[model samples]
Structures are given as C-alpha cells and as structure tokens.
Target: MGVGEQLVTYVTQNGYYIWEEFYRHFLMAAYGVLFASIVAIPIGILISRYGRLSKWVLSFGSIIQTIPALGFMALLMVTLGLGTTTVITTLFFYSLLPIIQNTYVGMKSVDQTVIEAAHASGMTRFQLLRKVELPLAVSVIMAGIRTALVVGIGIVAIGTFVGAGGLGAIIVRGTNATDGTAIILAGAVPTALMAIIADLIMGMIERRLNPANKASAASQ
Candidate 1:
C-alpha cells in the first residue's frame, strides 16, 4: 500500500488505541516538566539569593544540557533499568536548565530600588521574595517552562525505546516494519500538534502574567 493509504488504514482501524498512545506520550512529558519545575525553581530561587553561587549552579546545568539526550538515557538505563521511571527522570533533567536559568534571571531583573523599598517597608527576606521578586519574575519563569514543555514533548518521543510506551512506539514500529512513512506520521503528527498546543496555552499564560502586558492591555 502507498504510505498515505497505510496511514489512513492505520488511523481508521486503530483510532482508539492511537489516542491512548497520544495520552501516554503527553503524560510522559507533562509529568517530567511539572516535577522539573518544582525541583528547579527552588534551586533558582536559592542561587538568586546567593548570587555568588549562581554561576557555578548554572554552569552545572549547562553541562548537563550539553550531553546528548539518547546517550544520557542509555546511561540511566544501566542503573535504573527500563520503563517510565527512567524516561521521566531523564526528561526531568532535560527540563531543568531552562527553568532554573529563567527563574534566576527573572528574579534578578527585579529593580534594586524596588527591592530596597520592600526591605524598608519591613518585609522579611522570604516575604520580599514571595511578594516582590517572584511575582515580577513570573513571566521569565513561565517562558522557561514553555520552552521546556515543547522540548520535553519532543524528547519524550524517545522514551518508547526504553519500553516507556508513547507515540514514539508507533514510529519505532513503523521503522522496523519497512520504514512505513504513513505509520510514522500517525505518531509524528499528533506529537507535533501537542507541542504546538502546549506552546500556545503556555504562551497565553505567560502574557497574562507579564505585568507589562497587563498594563498595556489596561491602557488600551
């Protein structure tokens, strides 16, 4: 059959199963990004407070980012074995740099005068961070998250190699089965859509959180 015909047949016959794979693929990325944010954001906050340490912390993350994704996942497989745990952990590491760097940059960008004002107003260090620094820096932080989310979705497709079932499984199957272009597209198309939709949603959220965007809207 032609590739196009094969794709039509695959989708028509296995629509429900395909949807399940799509959901699994999404969950794999979503879980990684969510947890990465939780872990990295705090580290970013800590480094921001101790500016001397920020360079070293970010350098480590940058080093991790430089490692090839598949190679790192294979390394994890040696100790962790296979399946979703290994995949999630690998993807989690991939998601960290953008969030950590962005969070640090965002909070640091808050005006020193504003910070001093808050200090003079009797805010504790934690209070100043919670109320003043993080709020202003939220846009940059969200931008990092959005970047990670899109990147995570693409990377999670590789999870299938380790028995972490996702849409990538279909692509792998297609590659094994005569390099069927149609079979691969069934998985690839949806994965691309997930990236697009995630970016759009996260972008809207970022713009909403940005103070400048809010003020511009109010002015109009």
Candidate 2:
C-alpha cells in the first residue's frame, strides 16, 4: 500500500483511540504542570524575597534540568514504579527549573520605584507583591508556565515507555512494528500541535493578565 493509503487506514482504525490517548497525555501533562507550578511558584517567591536563597534555588533547579529525562524516569520507576505516579513525578521535576527561575526573575524584575511607591502608600509586603509586583511580573511568570506546558507535554509521551498510557503507545507500537511513518505521525504531529496550541492559549492569557501593557500596546 502507498504511504497515504497506510496512513488513512491507520487513522481509520485508531482515530478514536488516538484521541483518547492524546487526552490522557494532556491530562497527565496538565497534572505535572500544576504540581510543578504549585511547588515552584511559592519557592520562587520565597527565593526572590530572601535574595540569598535565589542563587541556591536556581543552582539546584539547573542541576535537576541537567539530568536527562529518560535517566530521571528510570530512577523514578525504581522508586515509584511504572504508572501515572511515576510519570507525573518525573514531569514535575523536569518542569521545575523553567517555572521557578522565571517566577523569581519575574518578581525580581518589578520596578523598584513602583515597589517604593506602594510602600510609601502604606502597602504591606503582601499588598505590594499582590498589587504591584505580581501584576507587573505576570507576563514573565506566564512565559515560564507556557514553556513548562510545552516542554511537559512533549516529555510526557516518554511515560508510555514506563507503562503510563498515552499517545506514546501508538508511537512505540508503530516503532516495534517497523512502521516508521506511523510512529512519526502519531507522536511528532500531535506533540507539535499541542505545543503550538498551548503557547497560543497561554500567550493570550499572559496578555490579558497584563492589562497595563495591553492598554499601552493598543494605544500605540
């Protein structure tokens, strides 16, 4: 059969299953992102506030990023066993560096004058952060989140190798079957599409969150 014919047949046979697998992958990735965000954001905020700790936190997170994803997955499988737990844990760890670093940088990047103004107006530290710093930092923080989501989505596919079901199964199956085309299309296509869609959505959200910048840009 021609490549086109094979592709048609494969899609016809597994379209629903593929979609189901994609959704499962998406959910797993989302879980990983959420978990990382919860942990990373607070740590980032604290690190930024402390200043002394920011260096250590960034260094530690960078070390984690240096560990290969597959190697990390292997280590996790030994402790957590092969399942959603392992996948989520690995993905969460992988996602930490970008989110944490970006959050810290974002918060720290807030204008000093703006912060002083807030404090002069009798704003508490929390109030200064919430009303002044966080709002200004939203774009950078969201940029980190967008990066995490995209990276996490692609890496989550590796979970299938450890028995966390997702679109990775199709790609793995196709590889074992010696159907290179199937593996490529099944894995590469969806992952790329998901990343693009996620970036676009997150970009919109980041823009919406930065109303001042949005307004200024609109006026220009």
Candidate 3:
C-alpha cells in the first residue's frame, strides 16, 4: 500500500496508543520550552542592560541555534549519553535564541521618554522594568517565545534518534523499516497539528497582553 492507504489501514487495524505518544511528545516540548524561557528571559534582560555586550552574547546563542538538531544531539550524547536528559537539554538550547533575542528587542523598543518619566518618579531600575517596560513589551517577548516554542515542537522529534522517546520514535521506526510511511505520517501529522495549535494559542496570549489591546479594553 502507498503511504496514504497504509496510514488508514494501520490506524484502523491497530490498537496502538498514538494518543499516548502525542501526549509524551507535547510534554517534552512544553518542558523544554518552559525551562528555556525561565533562563532566557533574565539573560535577555541583562543583554539589554549591557548594550555593548549584547551583540557577542546573542551571536553566540545564535550560533548554537544554527546547529542542526540531530548533530547537536550527537554532540550532547558524547558527554551526557542518550536519554530524556540529553533530549531536553538539546531542545532547551534550541529554544534560547528566539526567546532571548525577542526579549531584548522588545525591551529595547520601549520608549526612552517613558523610562525617563519613570526615573523622575523615583522608580528604580528594577521597578521600571517590572512595572512599565515588561508590561509594554509583553507582546514582543511573547512573539519570541512563541517562535521558540513552535520550533521546539518539530525539533523534539529528533530526540527519538537519541532515545528521547517522542512522536519521533514512531517516525524513526518507520524509517528503519524502509516502508513505514504510515508510521511516519502518524507522528508527523500530530506534530504539525500541535505546532499550529500552539501558535494560535500563543498568538492569542500575545494579543491579550499587547499594550494597544489593553488600552482598547480600558476604553470599552
């Protein structure tokens, strides 16, 4: 059977728990993205504070981001060996660039006049960042995070090659069989759907936190 016909046949005839695999896949992506965000946000804020240092720091992160997923995993395995730890670590690094870059850009984009106003009001640097800057830049920060999260979903698949079991495991099995097109589709379809759904969900969050939207809401 061809890929499409075999996919239908395999799904309808089998009792395999694709649902379980889907959940695991999502769990891995979520954990990795969340962890990266926790670490990246602070680094991004710091980068913005140190303008001269920003280029070098972000460039280094961008270099790490450019590494192919499989190749990155291979390198990690040499030090960490194969497991969920290695996979999550790989995904975490992959998630950093967008999160950090977007965060810095968003924060930097805040108006200098507003910052001066805050300073005149006796706001400390921390207060200015916490109360005014972040709120205004929330949408932009989310934009970066959203990009990272979406990309992480696809990259999580490569983890399977390193024993970081995910939907990728299903695809890998298919590839090994040299005719497991159905299996590959089974994993690929769900992964694509998850990425799309996440984008819509995150985009909604970005809009909600957008300063423009808040003003509109307040006027109503």
Candidate 4:
C-alpha cells in the first residue's frame, strides 16, 4: 500500500491507542511544566527582589538547559527508574530556564513609577507584589509558561525511551519495522498537531493576560 493509504489504515486501526498515548503525552508534559512553575516562579520572584542573585540563579538554569535531554533522563533514571517519572523529572529541569528567566524579566519590567505609586499608597512589600507587580508581570510569565509547554511536548516524545510510552513508542515501532513510513507519520502527525494546538491555546491565554490587550479591549 502507498504511504498515504497505509497511514490512514494505521490511524484508523489504532485510533484508541493513539488517543491514549496522546493523552498520556500531554499529561506528562503538562505535569512537568506545572511542577517547574511551582518552584521556578517563586524563585524567579525572589531573584527579582534580590537582583544580585538573579545572575547566579539564571546561570544555574542555563547550565541545566545545556544538558542533553536523553543524558539528563539517563542520570535521573538511576534514582527515578525507567518510567514516566524519569521523563517528567527530566522535563521539569528542562523547563526551568525559560520560566525563571521570563519571570525575572517580567517582574523587573514592571514600571518603577507604578511600584512607587503603590508604595506611596502605603502598600506593604507583599501587598505591592500581589496587587501590582504580579498583575503587570502575569502576561510575560504566561509567555514563559507557553514556551515551556510547547517545548515540553516535543521533549516528551523522547519519553518512550524510558518506558514512559506516548506517541514516541509508535515512532519507535515504525523505526523497528521495514518500510514503516506510514507508522512513523501516524505518530509524528499527532505529535506535531499537539504542539500546534498547545501553542495556539497558550498564545490566546497570554494575549488575554496582557495588560495592554486588556486596556485596548476595554476601550473598544
């Protein structure tokens, strides 16, 4: 059969399997980003407060980013074992750089005038951050999260190597078979689609969170 026809056949026959793997893939990626955000955002905020530490913290995150995904997972596997845990943990480390960097930049980007105004109003440090800085920085923070998630989707494809399953397994199966172009495309097509959908969704959320966009919409 032709590659196109075979692709259709494979997808049709494996609809449930594809759907299950797709769900698993998204969950792993999403969980990794979520976990990273919980830690990274707070650290980012702290570093923004203490400017001296920003360089060191970002440097460490960059170092982590320099590590190859497969190698990183291999190291984690020694403790986490061969499974989704290893994949998720690897993804978490991979996700840290963009998020922390963005958060720091976002917080620092907030207008000093606005911060001064908040302080003049007798707002405490915590209140100023919660009420003023966070709102202004939220869109930029969201942009970082969006980047992390889209990248994580791609990284999760490698999870199959660790026995984490996902569409990568299908791709691997295709590689093992003779003339498995159709099976490979069957896996690849969905992976690409997932990344595209995630980008679009996150882009929308980022736009919505943007203060300038909100102001423009309100004026309209």
Please, what are the lDDT tens digits per residue for candidate 1 over residues 70-153? Answer: 788899999999898888899899999999999999988999999999999999999998898988999999999999999999
Determine which window of 10 residues in candidate 1 has minimal summed lDDT: 173-182
Model 2: clashing residue pairs? Answer: none
Better of 2 and 4 by TM-score: 4
Compare the candidates by TM-score and give the number of the best one.
Answer: 4
Candidate 2 lDDT tens digits, 88-196: 9998998888999889999988889888889999999889888888888888888898899999988888889889988887778877776568555866578778889
Clash-forming residue pairs, model 1: none
lDDT of 4 by residue, 1-220 (tens): 7999999999999999999999999999999999999999999999999999999999999999888898899899999999999999999999998999999999999999999999999999999989999999999999999999999999999989989999999999999999999999988899999999999999999999999999999999
Residue 200, candidate 2: alpha-carbon lDDT = 95
TM-score list, all predictions: 0.95, 0.94, 0.93, 0.99
Model 3 weakest 10-residue run by lDDT: 10-19
Better of 2 and 3 by TM-score: 2
Number of residue pairs clashing in candidate 4, backbone atoms closer than 3 angstroms, sequence gap of 3 or more or interchain: 0
lDDT (Cα, tens digit) per residue for candidate 3, span 1-220: 6788999887777536677778888888889889999999999999999999899988989899778999999999999998778888988998988999999999999999999999999999889999999998889999988998899899888888888888888888878886887888887888899999999999999999999999999999
After superposition, the stretches of candidate 1 with alpha carbons farther than 4 Å from their true spots are 218-220
Q: How close is candidate 3 to the true structure, as a TM-score?
A: 0.93
Which has the better lDDT: candidate 1, or candidate 3? 1
